[model samples]
Target: MLSNTDIAELLARQAERESGILSRAFRRAARSAFLWPEEVANVIAQNRSLTELRAIGPFIERQIRHWIDKPPHSTHRAPTIRRDFVSLAKARQLLARKPAWAKILRGDLQMHTRWSDGSGTIAEMADAATDRSYEYIAITDHSKGLKIAGGIDEQALKKQGNEIGKLNAFLRKSGRNLLVLRSVEMNLNRRGEGDMSPESLLALDLVLGSFHSSLRIVEDQTNRYLAALRNPHIQILGHPRGRIYNFRIGLSADWPRVFAEATSLNKAMEVDCYPDRQDLNIDLLKIAREHGTHISLGTDAHHPWQLEFIELGLAAALKAKLPADRIVNFMPIGELKSWVREVRGRAPRRP
Candidate 1:
């Protein structure tokens, strides 16, 4: 039976051959495949209409039926933007092969609450993590530099910390083992400088530095990645490439050298698992694995329920055969903190 990915590719190819609203609809249906919760074939086996899926209408449903009946032959390669993303259905299939791997996940390294653009509050996010049985989850809200995302300033960050502390106490009192880690997605400029003060950053449990601007530059970005890795405040580099599916192609760089620098520094490059933003996709992940680079997985979730997105990153890591030892999420809470402390201690003091 064809997976949702196969149906998506068929729709995308069909879209390329047409024009106007019909073509746009096909493209939208293609992108929607990643978000669809069930396999189209399974839905068909149950005698369900394809319109039950997102972005599928009667017309698109009929087209999907045709493809399902007689799958089209894929003659050309998918563009970089649309390639290598594993849908949730596919991720589940891969994880079933090693049931133990999913159980080892202790926490989610990156997420947001209403403190930033996220729709959920800290308490709501915590509740969701508890459902997943995660021992901890980092609240990496946007820092002041990313004003577009309603980034928080130093004072606001401290206030957020207090809130997290209270929540932790409550969880402890309630016999819940979850810890909400304090972290911020500090915005980095093209020069690899972060907007938040170094002192403020040091106060957090962990820090993730990311590039929010100059993402569309077509030139190489090896130097940028190097400088960001060397920045003393950041323990993890978030979404290293800034790529979005079928939209931004992301930056080009000598990835081997980049991963080597990350490895030497003992810092991690994130596998941002957001469906539309699966940066550090499988191809680059293979290189990182070859260099034995530390890999951090984060759903980059804007809402609590989106934590399920981690499966995509986990599957990508599994596909690349990334060693379990190098994956930070596999570490227990204490070990994870120890890794953060080690990296922070090695960073040079800022003036």
Candidate 2:
């Protein structure tokens, strides 16, 4: 039987062989394969219409059914850009085998709201987190540097904080356990420098710095990783590789040295769980494990529903055999805050 992974590969290869709108449809279906909650084969077995799946229409569905009816004799391993991504169905299977691993997770470390380009409001995101029993969730909206994403300025950051404060107060009064953290997905230059002001970042519960430019560089970026970790304002390096599925290959770095620097500095590296951008994937997480580096799981959620993406990152950490204590999301809210404080304390004092 062809797994979703197999089906996805076939679709991607089919895309390469086609042209125009047909090729775009195949490519889209391939990417959506990761988010499909059930295997296409299983959906077929249930006598359900394949159109129920995201990005699948009659044509794409028929193509996928043909592949399911006749499994390929041999499917080549995916290229680097498409490799190592865990489908939601596969991630769910992994977590099902080890239910306790996911139970330990207390919160999500990154998300966006209407303060930036996200579709949901802060309250909506909070309500969704509450549904998931999350104790906290960070609102890491884009900073002013990423103007393309409706990034917020420092004044806007403060105003967003005010709304968060009111929401937290209401949650407290209503006896909800959830806390919305004030944060920004600060854009980083190729030199691994952040775009937001130090004063602006100081008000946040935590900060996530990420590279948004020069991601296509073919050079080794060990120094870039080092510089980002050394950045006093950032506690987590978001999507360290800046890779996207079937798109950019992202930057390269001396893995061991990067993990070691992050470890020594008490900084955390993120497993960005966006379906198309599961950066710091299982392979790198294993290297980080060897160094006992801190691992943070963030859905990079743009909408409330995307919170479910956490499973992909959670399963990756479990496969990597990362120590539970080293994964910050497993920490209770108070302990999670303390870890951020400790990480901040260790940053070099700026002038």
Candidate 2 lDDT, tens digit per residue, 1-351?
A: 888888888999999999999999999999999999988888999999999999999999888888888888878899988998889999999999999899999899989888899999999999999999999999999999899999999999999999999999999999999999998999988778888889889899999999888899998989988988888889999999999999999999999999999999989999999999998899999999999999999999999999999999999999999999899888888898898899888877887
**Model 2 misplaced stretches (Cα beyond 4 Å):** none
Candidate 2 weakest lDDT stretch, 10 residues: 65-74
Steric collisions counted per model: 0, 0
The TM-scores, one per candidate, come to 0.95, 0.98
Candidate 1 lowest-lDDT run of ten: 71-80
**After TM-score superposition, what is the CA distance of residue 322 in candidate 1 from its true location, in Å?**
0.9
Q: Please, what are the lDDT tens digits per residue for candidate 1 over residues 203-316?
A: 899999999899999989999999989888898999999998777888889999999999999999999999888888999999999999999999999998999999989989
Model 1 RMSD, rounded to 1 decimal:
1.6
Q: List the residue pairs that clash in candidate 1.
A: none
